[model samples]
Target chain A: MGVGTGNTVLKVDGVTKTFGGLRALDDLNLTIEEGTVHAIIGPNGAGKSTMLNVCIGQLKPDTGTVTFDGEVITGKQPFEINQAGVSRVFQTPAIFEDLSVLQNVMIPAIAHRDGKFKLNPFSILEKQDDIEGRAVEILERLRLTELMDKHAGSMSRGNKRRLELAMCLVQQPRLLLLDEPTAGMSRHDTNRTIDILKQIKEGGMTKVIIEHDMHVVFSVADRISVLARGHIIAEGTPDEIKGNPVVQEAYLGGSVE
Target chain B: MKKFFANQWLVMLVFSAVILTMPIWLSPIGAGYPDLLQKFMIFGIFAIGFNILFGLTGYLSFGHAAFLGVGSYAAVWSFKLLTMNVLPAIIFAIIVAGLFSVVIGYISLRRSGIYFSILTLAFAQMSYNLAYSVLTPVTNGETGLQLERADPRIIDSLFVEPTEGLPLTNFFSLSLSGYEGFYFCAAFLIIGFFISLRIFRSPFGLKLRAIKSNQTRMQYTGFSTKPYLLSAFVISGMYAGLAGGLMAATDPLAGAERMQWTASGEVVLMTILGGVGTLIGPLLGVGIIKYFENIFSAINENVLMAAYSGLPEGLQHFLVTVSSPFVGEGWHLTLGLMFMLVVIFLPGGIMEGFDRIKRLLMKPFSRNKDAVESAEEGH
Candidate 1:
């Protein structure tokens, strides 16, 4: 599939992040267009997670700039970045484990709808039909309506990941970041997750994902960027990445020649 | 819909009924019974407020007693300078405590988890020391603030009759004494309890739980966790202040020991023993601990020997001496043991222990229902 839709949502220019003597990200340059899935693949300690963190405001880069929707967000707080409509899901299912699934989803929904935290006891939460309706609709989309009343902690790993996605999706973010969304899943679960992600992309949400599994990267990614030692060595379509000799040697650890 | 009512008004009604009638039931036992019940309700309010911060947020502050002391001192000062009208004194006390919490919380929440708890503890110790020495004019130099009988009543102070030697109310010869004082304190406890209940059900309450679980996730979900945490802190502090104010209202005395770190620790024990995160658990905890302090402390060798006297002299002396430390002033030893057992065996508290018994009793009746639900949920 073709990228470069002329609607770049995230533009990272000459970004570098360093920790003490080590360079986690070195002059990383990338542009993720709107309504597409952009995947980054590399070995361990490749700074894939760091890049996502910087974009989502969890970490700040040492050098270079990040522009999202024509606004500089290089050093903003994570909550500020989130309020600007960028959201992320962690590798592990980070949810309020004790709260019910419905309550979990309602948290971000309440923050989004109310603009500030409302603590009035007299205000009936059950009367908020709009919020409830939207939450139910999102839960239905993820087939989690039946599990809404259940504690989020007890859900299986696959369902937990799905629930995390639902939480991120409920915010209706402009750009979504997924950090190893299918990291520990079986092959079948991985494929099923790819299908869910494909649906998310088809619904016109821009995505930046870091994946170690090349099968998942190739299955849904509109464009692929191969990173080695914290630098993007190649950026191309799936076929170009699959055939690139340098990428094969650097990433696949061998060459067919 | 019926289940919803159970979740709402049923709890309120039970709390109200217990607060209303507890002193009456206890007063017939002795002259000091109402006073003991009043103390229980006052501390119950304190723990319920404290649970919002510690139990809900999982921030174990070891200095919360400072707010209690602040409230008591503020209320006593109001009686000293302005008037003995409990309403304005309570309002002033709570506002001062809320403002104090804002400053402390802003600084303490900067470091989370263990750091936050330690920081709060340090602040509380600082307050205790300052009250004992540095802030002599304000805190009265450990002598504690006492209500002056001849103090001017500038603003509708509690009308007192010299004959009764206590505050009195007009019409029907009613007075704010004996069971009436206990009832007044009980009403405040009911209000504090319901307010806590509302806070537990609100969306803000859910976010507080989320912050407790994973604050980073909450931050990414567009919540500045600081504001929520700060608000919870202020609300909890105000609740403690209200309890302190009511304590002074009932007794008209304030002491520096009220703000001691051990006092703060006592409330923590109360919350954990009753069931941290359970709405009614803190009340149960405060009631149990207070009962132990009042009733168990009254149990002496004479009472014990009187009951088990015919069981030979050696056995009687052995039992009374062995249990002596747990009775009559060392009752906190028993409380400490109770807290340890509850924490170790039932980390969920007395509520969890009660729940275990309930599940055991219901096992045979709901076997198929639980089996079906557990299978579907997949653990």
Candidate 2:
């Protein structure tokens, strides 16, 4: 409820999505500010993913308008939405597994700068040094510089998730959407991820994260929205969300104290 | 350009040397004849193009031969109306086949995996039936579309009248028959191989491999995979078309059977047997299969007897009896056995077999080098 303070970069208004007999998303309204970490926490089947999918244009809403940077992105193609500077990391690690770590990051970097499609049949070799330099810089920042040549698929699940984030971040997206970014990670890896995300936050890009871990949500989120039965039930800062009776009853199960 | 040649020039040089000197080396193996050599180059191009789609993109097209047949028909029509020049025939075939691929690729690429393959198969079968029956006016049905002495040659009026002998397809004054025909096809094959090498290392090629790895991931990565796949399909189809046109130019006939599903399967077999994704693997597969088709099938009883004459009387008889099923009229049986062995022992195909052999050969040399280095360090 009016939690976002800065200029709104993404606005989802009256969005409803239904799959056959199931109403996955119902009259969902969300606003993500230009430079903040907004976390969406919900129970199973609470439509966190559905909202992310709608924003990324993976699933068209039954009735609503989703706008990004003043442009309606409700029915646009996934690539078109991505071209509009909205990037998503899936729940599971969705990366070009067969490609090396460098290539995995380079692909998005190329797509980011070159637009959707370029013939580029002859310039790969000439462009390799520059691309690889950029890729190496990203890998260094992620502390994955040593594994740059390793296949993305062969890496650990936690590292794959990191690589996926590196791929998304290399695009320098205006709006980043991450679905369970730290799912299945060890505590150490989760902390490392928190640190990386903290660095990313300092870079001043708006991020909408769907998270199940309360630790991650409380640690990183500037604003937290609690969802139950496909609607936002509570929205506030971390302290407010932790103390809110409605959020505790709906998601936290009881009072944290 | 310098970087392009850094990794590929050696391969290009070796390929050129082997293809250009085929007559000298193949004579000892009895595959030196022009017709067999020409078939080798034509099928080599076909398999190479097929690899661009099936091998790189991982979209197995079951009806690729339709493009080949379309190309042949286009070339034949060019011959009928235009001059006997092979240039126009080859060019027209490529254009027609490219157009045909665009239609088929647009429809079939809407689905993927097995469903995509089935769609292509259905389209190819439909084209085959139409060519055999309804489109007989163009294809000439079972007898096939053949060059006729009475047909108009509009481009060059030098030989308009009916002649007793058949006119050969030519490039200027030189005829496209005998060694010249083999050389012509070989030239195209080499050029195709170089183009394939470029594609394999290109940025577009990386996108195709990405699609093969994960289509969902590629789509979300801001790539419209449909256009990339369609481009690959059309490019591959044109490769098939170029091969078909070369076939017509060499022999002056386009048959409905060229569009048969078996012909499509043959190119797939060639690509898989040599190695699915390697640059020269498809061509190597083509050479092996064509060699068996020509030389293996040509080994009559007399040749078998001569081959075994140096052995003991009992052993010679036994050897000939045992090998008879694998040679001459039974070459297909040999091919089947070879395919099974390759599939079982070398799933990566003949290139994998070659790689294994190379590694085996290098093992001892590497060990010896390491030992020598250690001894020098001790001193």
Candidate 3:
């Protein structure tokens, strides 16, 4: 299978990261095209999440460069990287649980428009109807409109994950990163997440998803990369990745289909 | 403008009404005196500013009293060299305190949680020591910085005689003393409250709350949390400075003890005892603590006996004996007990208690509304 027809949006070349004696990411290279869903699948302790962290500026690699849309983002602050059009959804759903669901989504939208900092201490926040409208629109699409007034921490796990996604999507980032977005979700919730992701894919936003579920992997990924021992072992289309013996032995373990 | 007033008119009305009538109403409770009332408004401003940082951002600075002391010094110096007018003194105080906070906040914000608290505490203690010893030439040593009659008052000498009794802080010819002083403080208190209200309803305020809720999530959401925290810190320090300036404005004295760590701790107690994150909580805390300090400490055995004279002799004796430890010089004991009770039963402080009571009172009305809604749905 051939790579998707688009320019490279993100490039991770020769990235190596170490935590004391353990090597988390070792000379890893990845190229994700714009407007495509790329899945990085690996077994536990295989550095899939670590690579995602490196890409998102959460962890700096000992040696390598992370270029997003052609500008280097390595060693940039997380907020700076996010400002550069990269957004991430964590494995455990990092959300402002104390704030209402509406607030949770509105924050990123505000950040997207206002940049890193804007001190408008006198303007009433409620008067920003456009921002509120956009937040509500995203909530409606995520089927979270009914829960907009509810505190995000009180939501069920599935809803929390969806809210986290809504937060990222509200920013309308050019590149989205998901670290095991469907890690602990139920099958029904997993299917629902897949539907949402498919809708996002149709919007033409580039995505890098680290998922373990083969069903999720096969359903949404336009291209697949298998990782093992802190290195990318294989890269291809889903069908090619499924047939590749090295990917099967290293991560897939057997025929996934 | 109408819309803005429409939203805030009730708060403004109530605040003005309460502060304006405080002198009249407090007389009944033996707290109508200018000195005590001035303390209320000054500390009320301090607590309100402290609430902005501690309440919104959840970064507790234990060195806030340093700013307060700095403001007092700046204000006193202004009165000595510049003018006896309170305006320049207040402005100088706020700017000095703001600069001090920028330095301290920049260093303290590097570490959050308990470390931030300790760093602030260290800075305040250091300031206190420096003021008491090495900075004596500036601070006037342990006797504290006092306005001297011999000091040249360029502005005051041009207008009035310097040989006159202590030069009082004034707004033009209107002296900042007696009922006028109380009104002056009350006006500033209203301004402080209004500013805090605006902040509470602003996007900047929302960001501060977001920081309080989750700093890591805020950073990932593309917010540089440090600058936001620093802004809050400086704003809070300016508030403390304003309070200090007001204190010096009224009394015309600046003491090293004002910058002590305990003074910082007092503001913390005022904030927490009032409510950590509520708009009106810190002011209420200030009122309660100041009331206890001024009124309760004045309640001697004779006053207690007079209050309990109607009771049976044995019962009155027993009551006074049991209560003696919690009144007069033991007023701190009462404050401590109240703090413990509030912390234990109302973790959200006095505002939480008010909220609980308000909820309990509104329970029946809310249930009726729910019933009406359900009936409409059934129809």
Candidate 4:
């Protein structure tokens, strides 16, 4: 269940992250309000992932403030940021392949619910009924209840994406940062993922998704920001971004007459 | 209900049962089964600890035996100064090894993959060299450290003596007779097995595996993987120390050779050969290697000659010449060959082979059920 009203939950102000001489992200500034699906659209090497990394503390911006719920979390460790309610799903499904899908989802849920790294040998699964019940519900929402017993590695790419999304959802994260949620999916699977995202947003979760597919972005994005050369060129509602000259120039090439 | 056997705990329980029953079943055969079994269990403990570090974290440590050696030395020192109590000795060994692993893991983990392995190996070699030369009084140099009968143990406790001419301890208290020591070793192995099982199921263990699979991803998930990796390294090192402490308890000695690079290689071989990630594979690998070392190495030319009387003269002579290298001294060559074969053919070790056979047997029936389910779903 996504928490909070759609007021500004995360603020990234004038953030710049550079690797050696190459500017991965240049003077990026964006404010994500609570309870809305925000889409970051850009081409390859467009610094989309870098911006996500900076926001979540995987990478430090050379100069900028990333404030989540009013705390400066720019240089914090990934886990610390995660504990603060920012969860990320990787481009490639990063799941425990050998573990059952239930165990895979159970791990992060347990970590979040217990609020500490657990060391006791007692059955954590047994003790955590609410977490387990919620995880099962999330899996059901994704139509992954039947695959709960299957090894995560045994699943196809589409199913793995669902599993990753389920893991993030099960954490009940404040802001779920997804990198290409439908990266390697077929058309049917992409549409299904869009449907899932639509349902999640409808259910009141704040999501920031980076997608290469313009169709996927247009389908569920409440606000669209067009990023070009490490800076946001335009930010508005879907209709405005769709008609903006800069956005068209950035995506369609050359100056629009 | 029948499918419950697929649970990891059930497999571990079966393994523990087999390891525990070895002495009882094999002692009647009059072969030195108990002695071999004890050695296997000790090395098995060593490999299990090693598998946690190398298998779970994907950190290949080539210097792990340094911790084992450190444990042995720590136990021997405790034996020399404190009580002859095995508990204190083991505790000291574990603490020392854990500390050593921390220092090593810290430096080694800074680099990933092959560099990490090389760093560990270099550190281990340094440890071995220092123990052999610079640390003469503490390590006792080439002669290694040995128990003197005159060394005063504050709390006088009697331990079982070693078997005749074996020059090691018996069970915990009785003496180092083959039967008693074997059981003592078996008991510790079972304990180590359970501890490993706990570590595997713990949340900490889950994080360690996550680090192995995707360190960067784990970090992004808000877990600093360094501490988790280091903690696992120390825990595994403590297991190595326990194995070393048991060795000291049995033989009451510590040698630089125990921490040698070859010893490190042997444990890696054991873990890989048995099944790198599987719980029981390392023990099986240890048993396989030790079996060749203890039993095959004992077969000499005289033994071969004794058996030759039953064969034709030319065939007997040919057999002796061809088999000479594999028996008595060259058994390690055979072991190396076996390791290579296992690595190549059974990459998952005995566990993979076992799983393959099980899957093959279940496949025909299992596939039909899945097909039937889909057929029903279509309706």
- In terms of DockQ, the best-performing candidate is 3
Report the C-alpha lDDT of model 1 over B1-379, residue by residue, as the tens digit: 2255347788788669867877566656542477787788889989999999987788888888999999988887877766656777788789888888888888998998789989999999899998989898888776787755665655534454333353432212444566777777888888888888777776677778888988888888988888888888999999988988888877777888888889998999899999998888898899888888778888888987886788888998998888888887888789888889999999999989988998899898799897888898996
The candidate, 1 or 2, that scores higher on DockQ is: 1
lDDT of 2 by residue, B250-365 (tens): 98899989998999998988998999877778989999999998899999878989999999999999999999988999999999999989989998899899889988989999
Tens digit per residue, CA lDDT, model 4, A20-53: 9999888889998899898998777889999988
- Structure candidate 2, residue pairs in collision: none
Order the candidates by TM-score, highest first — what do you get?
3, 2, 1, 4
Best by lDDT: 3
Candidate 2's TM-score reads 0.94
Could you tell me the TM-score of candidate 1? 0.92
Docking class of 4: acceptable
Model 1 iRMS (Å) reads: 1.8
**Lowest lDDT 10-mer window, candidate 3 chain A?**
A248-257
lDDT of 3 by residue, A1-257 (tens): 34355789999999999999999998999999988999989888999888988888889899999999999999999999999889999999899888899989988999999999998899888888888999999999989997898999999988999999999999999999998898789989899999999987777799999988899999999999888999988998889988898877776775443
* Model 2 whole-model lDDT (C-alpha atoms): 0.89
Model 4 gets an lDDT of: 0.81
Worst 10 contiguous positions by lDDT, candidate 4 chain B: B162-171
Tens digits of lDDT, candidate 3, B1-379: 2254447868799889998999899899999999899999999999999999999999998999999999999999999887899999999999999999999999999999999999999999999999989999999989988888888878888878776677777988889888888889889999999999889888899899999998998888899999999999999999999999999999888998999999999999999999997888999999999999999998988888888999999999999998888899999999999999999999899999988998999999999998997899799
What DockQ, between 0 and 1, does each candidate earn? 0.64, 0.59, 0.81, 0.44
Candidate 3, residue B237: how far the Cα is off, in Å? 0.6
Looking at candidate 3 chain B, the ten consecutive residues that score lowest on lDDT are B1-10
The candidate maximizing TM-score is 3
How big is the positional error of residue A75 in model 2, measured in Å on the Cα after superposition? 1.4
